[model samples]
Target: VVDFAKFKNLIGAGFINAQRGLDDSTHAEKDILGKILGKLFRSGNTDAAPSEMKESTLALKQVVDGMQKTVDTDFRTGVAKLLPGLKIFGYPGISDSELSTETTLNVGTILESHTRIRYDQGDGLFLPETYNGLGSRNLIYMLFQLYEFFRDWQSRLIENGIYLIFIEEPEAHLHPQMQQVFIKRINEIVDQFSTTLNVGKPWPVQFVITTHSTHIANETEFESIRYFLTEKNQQRTTRIKDLRKEFRASDLEIDKQFLHKYLTLTKCDLFFCDKAVLIEGPTERILMPNLIEKVDKNLTEELKLKGQFISVVEVGGAYMHHFYKFLDFLELRTLVITDLDSTALESGKYPACEVSKGTHT
Candidate 1:
């Protein structure tokens, strides 16, 4: 769980550093905001003052000054009177030296503690983000993180480096439609930011999204998907099957296009499942679950399919062969259920007939 206010404060700190023309390497070592405020009030250095000051910064300075005044009048005076009587191991303490306190404002701390994300309800009323739905919160947080990464790129925090962002299971809280929309729109959002904020140079960022949602996988381009398969060996090593290269190696453009369109339209879960059943029609697909259950009930517990993840696909007899290469590439245990259409040749013409009466199959 990310503290949204703290993330915003970090972004604010980055912006302040950029505004001050401070070197990026020294950001961790220096308190840029504190130094700016010290120059403005304590040193009275007009030349060092920033051209613009935010209202938040002004309020923070006032709070720091009020705290300093309270410490000076109340805490310091009280401690001074008590110092004469204070003794350590029967040795009397001297009260000749006065104790002084210095107060420094930390903008990050103040803003993080005070800031809250609120949604504007009608009539100027606002509701806190905590009141929003979990799905919305998750989506908002993900987008904000992306924005922060984009800002980092725009600020040139790490020059000449590629920003590789790995978004693990972004579809966790999102609905199927929203998951599809997110996969479709994420790259567009990054490209838009790069073009608008980064001038001519593109944001050197690449996204590697890992998702179990069929909606997200369907929405993603075929070339971008990599299927990971765990081998049934002692070590159980994982193998990555790059869809683009696999399809390209076959040199079947029509088959590749057909498979891509078929998966996109059907939103098949074949990619995530352990085993698959390729059926000839809707009837077989509809009855697959019951068929598996019946078979599982009669088999031994170890051999039963009750706990196995199996995906049933209705590809029709004419198109079932098209998926053979894909299923083979995945190394999935597949059961193809297609009708064996028997035919009879008469005068060089083959016509369909019953299996018992037909000569060829």
Candidate 2:
């Protein structure tokens, strides 16, 4: 049921629950709340005896029940609510037919609610194999799978407990438009869950993601970003948030609008790149990634598996100074592969990396 090709991914979940019988075989002392919350979500029964259930399980069951009743009452009205300024489509003879065939996701069964996306074939009914099939659209399939994973993660969020979600390479199969809007949609959903129960206070939910999409990283706030590197067979993370001693105060004053705009214009991959090879043109950008893969398959395979791949950025020779000036705390190994096209070694046109005698950068 990890796949979400169809809205109902639970076709086999009940079978798995029956096979495992996770609760039946365990004792109260064995599956404590600490242990249960620490693990992935397992099926629970609300009808079970009090001694047999954990406090976290009961809370989720109650939350799901309350949300279910609110949605059910809207179904009795027999008409869907239309967004303002949007009118329902009307055909010549089908004006009386309902705007769209109704299909509701089963959040009432302790599942998450989903908005059904449908396309009209010949008949008006929202039939199978309409538009949900991934044969034509690959982006929808990839995002659908990510949502399935997130839905499962949400069940593990015990009330008043810290929860985290991890994702890697969310840009898979996504177009530029989808990539730009991805993090915004996720933030909206997280904000909703936090404020659902208490009006003023929200739940604490955080997540980490590894990606190569500058579009996704550009959408992210500066505070949420962290750089990662592997040095001498040991992995390290760079938290730019508290690196005041190592970085200059001026480095922290980067303009948010300029950052997003410059990255978008230059198509800079610095936002999510693990290691960077800064070049001077499109010729290197198109050829360097494949060239690196061919040079060392082992490094390439590791990067692919861990989602920490290197990025080749094409920064024009003139603008490199501005880039180096702003991102002073770039911890990733950067190789400034610029051309020594100038006769004067002392000319100021090139990037600052050249004038610094290659000591760092």
Candidate 3:
């Protein structure tokens, strides 16, 4: 086991890093199915299982432990627990050995595993299959699991000198409102292990995240953010840390509060996209992707923009001022895709700002 005590002397922050991935490109890592199939045929570890648990097995343990703590312990959402049952195939299970309440789980005896999760989903408890049958909220469940899993996983890795974890789009398949909360809570995992292997000292685990989520970005330190400004074939990185250093030299003031507010209000996902298309009205929001895909090679060719283009659609011309601050700061090449006539809003019931949208903000 790696000792985190010496690690603290080298760094300041705690070990946990919850890197958010809000785009499709991030989904490559999220392909759990392909990953599972991948491990079956790989030629690396022989007999292969070492005396110690495999990396994947260790990851699964942290994930299970994390999920148990986050879900099963919280009263607001009720306690969600993960129960790993032994695969009773050719070998016999301990089903008849003891009372359900009295038996202790010994993981070594288990072959494959089946998981049971607890929540009030109409019925008393549900299986992964049960939730999948519902045909909704599957993505949300997975994201929550991933969040808790990595939150715990990072602390475990901190025993070593330094472990760098790269997090991609964390906001994929999550409801918009939950996006804000998810980003905010991910960092708390650091505090959970604030003094690991040391008294009053902190262990810093590096987490590098590339995100398209403004929500996640808002929760982070501005100095940590680096924007990719892509125009034509030229791309340059704008580091907020460097910007602050330069602005201080030039005696210029940047309104950071405006940046935070704009990000919070719009919750725009713009950090890692090639470009952005600003728009208003549902018609433009609904239609622009198809229209742009025909012309913009980046939207179709890039792995990040598989389903959607790199864009942010404003409510309309009326609210352009709200987003201007953010647009100006990033200096991103933003394409304004508007109806221009303004008749669309006048003809119909204006897009209700009070929309439930999804879960919570």
Candidate 4:
């Protein structure tokens, strides 16, 4: 069991690394799937035939199923709590218009196993717990359950009283087609279930997303798109919206530029500026040193004790979290002052600035 766990752990870790480095042609560990197959064969625990290999894979799956059964009590409970209204298709008296109070769920690999789906007792979707048993179902099957659960529940939520749907990282572990389908389903639910807005009536049910996927970004309405840039050491963020430019690619060509833009956005968030001042807007930024001069003729003088020259930078929005570390890396002390009215308040208060990088001049 310990050896199996080690093997599984190594295989899982390799998959994560492989996904991240898929774009690099020079990366040596490119064929992670091939490596996994080789490792399984080299273990020599199973017999040396193709049929034996298949049986070994099934045995591994069974072990997984046994482990999941032990943990699924908590997993099942958590899933239930998240779902309040669920009108399953098979249940009697479950009409389309009325909200459902109960659901039946099964979690496992229904696709791979010819096993019939018999439920214990519940009131939601089926999330199979085992399939053809090597220990349980593969991770991919588990993900599919989540996808089905969310998709159906979201459809109902929109039908009821959805004003806006905010999705973060919806593209995680999903293909581009699945991402597009998810969005299309959401739109369909909105049209099917929402109340039509009268001339001055507000539109009910809008969608807002913060995503890292280029495919998802491209599929969305161009007008709704916003891009943010961050400088790591300087601790700066710039938000741009309603861009007069559009970058698109045809099916024949890969959108490397769009992908590069996404990478650059992430890179800026790690920027390193030695000593920086964070300003709310363009004009006030220009006058920070002078304003500080007027407010405390000794502010810059005091800052000099930190041993660094300061540059006042204007970030489009207040995203100090992304830029602060970069500024500190460049040995800079940051003094950030922004007008609250111009920007939406972020979820949390500004973190205390770290000034360790710069020495007192």
Candidate 5:
């Protein structure tokens, strides 16, 4: 859930507390923010003054103090009187003598209730996040969350720790170009944090992003991708295919580079498809879907390809062989449709000819 209300706690003591093995319902006295404020106002530090605290912290304290005063004077008096009248049945009358007014400031509550995400619409004009498009809001939310994570890590609340962040389908509300941009820039954001901290090799953060966007996948490095496959068995177990090892052999260097470049350039979504159709050129690429529909019409429902996910790639006959090993690696059922440009050698050159007259194919 992308609830802005919970964002504060997620990025604040709530996250740090969880890392410290503390319960979610931890008292404010034990909270990180509360502890910091308590240290500043302790008996020995009485002369520290509110000026020593951050402006926001002092403001929060003032608001909470005013609310506490109001509750004690107006609300608690009525509750105290009502407590004496509750001497019902055989139970002893409720005692209000020991009751004392206490107020606790919840950072999450303040942020959720008081914070407003406003956008500068124009000169002296502003609009709330609610008025913005969902895509824009989502993008802003994700980037802010990333920054919060970096800040939390930099706080060093937990020593010798690493953050395993799982960003699922970040492309949800993003356009193709935005998705590509996100893929390209996400690492830069993390890298900047690492540089600031002067972190050594294997920085204390790892991101596992699962995306269905071809643009994102295309922008990402081939070695970083992991394809999840569900086995077609009774148990239906899941398997992971590490693309880094797919063509790692020295002999397959050219094939690996070619596959990477081809997929990146074309933005082919073969990684997410159930079936693939490798065609000769633009002609077959354009007509393959309709051709499949026509063929499907003649087949039984069980054998039809009407509802199956299929990807078509325009790999010309001369280059189609490049994907042979790659497609086999994916275990994808594929159909190769190519034109046989039959020719015969006459003198020193091979000329196009009919199949019957062609000496070479």
Candidate 6:
């Protein structure tokens, strides 16, 4: 009679082969053999067809001949090599079912090897979307790598006694708070490294950055500020005229409180004055009034010139526009002649209406 038990053992072995990327579909064929034996081989058949008889004769001969061999030296040793974790039963010892259990352990080994290789290759790296793979990574690693490269470059610059550093778009791709941290991170890293190295001098890296970020702009002082204004015709432009030491102690004190903190009030004054004509500003005030008197020859004379009382305000161009409408409200004859600023005219909202077809100045 055919052995159904031996057929089931082969099927379990085939499964392990497939999982290990080994050749063969022996398991499926063995299962088919088991089903066939269960249905057709209930009774022992002494007489059979020529082909069937021959196959059974050969198989039976092999079994009887194999039984004559020493179980310990031949079959047991060979099986132990093939299936390491094979467990044995009682007197019958090591049935085909027990061999199948041993093969199950081999299948686990195959699966583990494949899984480890996949993990090492970073299976999720090329995936289009995110994955929860244990070996996956994020952009922080790339950022840290880039930071190391730049820190080395900055150190070289410091070694040569380089003082100036300019960076544009330092806030690129970052939120406001992140931009602040970005600056802080650079500052902290450079200072810390430089301190440890004792490079050239203290705080070796000084920076000048151009940024449209309001947070960055707010962090600057007046000396670091530079303002430029262009007017309607685009021909007029001006920059702050320095008069740092020209003013008296009182004027400088006034400017200290006014220039930076009260820029709004100063800008408005420019709009109200008929000719802003920035004189020697804070320090310039000491000699500006006298200079105007000298030029106009009005040492002792007073004339009712309409809008001629030019308020020579001593302030920067930024806050100049602050007082434009305030003076206009007071019905003062004002002209902001300090800079060729078109901020008022650019909006096309000045008080002057477009002249009619027949009108001419």
Strongest candidate by lDDT: 1
RMSD (Å) of each candidate, 1 decimal:
10.4, 19.0, 17.3, 25.0, 9.3, 31.1
Residue 82, model 2: lDDT of 46
How many clashes show up per model?
0, 0, 10, 53, 0, 10
Task: List the lowest-lDDT window of 10 residues for candidate 5.
Answer: 14-23
In model 3, pairs of residues that clash are 21-168, 21-169, 21-170, 22-169, 22-170, 71-80, 72-79, 72-80, 177-360, 177-361
TM-score of 2: 0.43
After superposing candidate 6 on the true structure, give the runs of residues whose Cα lies further than 4 Å from its correct spot: 1-158, 178-189, 196-203, 228-361
C-alpha displacement of 322 in model 4, angstroms? 32
In candidate 1, what are the lDDT values of residues 14-53, reduced to their tens digit?
1211122223333232333333333233222223322232
Alpha-carbon local distance difference test for all models: 0.68, 0.49, 0.48, 0.43, 0.67, 0.40
Better of 3 and 5 by lDDT: 5
Candidate 6 per-residue lDDT, tens place, 1-361, comes to 6687544322211010112221132322112212223222221122322244346545644664465455535656666777644334344445434442121212222222322211133855543212222112112222332333333333231232334455554545456566555654666666665565334345344565556554444334444543333333666754432222322346355544454354433333332234545432465667665666666664334552322656565555555554443333333454343432222233435333344421222
> In candidate 2, what are the lDDT values of residues 71-93, reduced to their tens digit?
56765344455422123454465
Q: What is the lDDT of residue 46 in candidate 2?
A: 28
lDDT of the structure predicted as candidate 4: 0.43
In terms of lDDT, the poorest run of 10 residues in model 4 is 12-21
Kindly report which residue stretches of model 3 are placed more than 4 angstroms away from their true locations once superposed.
1-112, 118-158, 195-201, 229-231, 234-250, 268-331, 334-361
Residue-level lDDT of model 5, residues 196-218, one tens digit each, is: 54343334666778777888887
State residue 3's C-alpha deviation in candidate 1, in Å.
Answer: 32
Q: TM-scores of all models?
A: 0.71, 0.43, 0.42, 0.26, 0.72, 0.28
Tens-digit lDDT string for candidate 4 (310-331): 4555554544444543343333
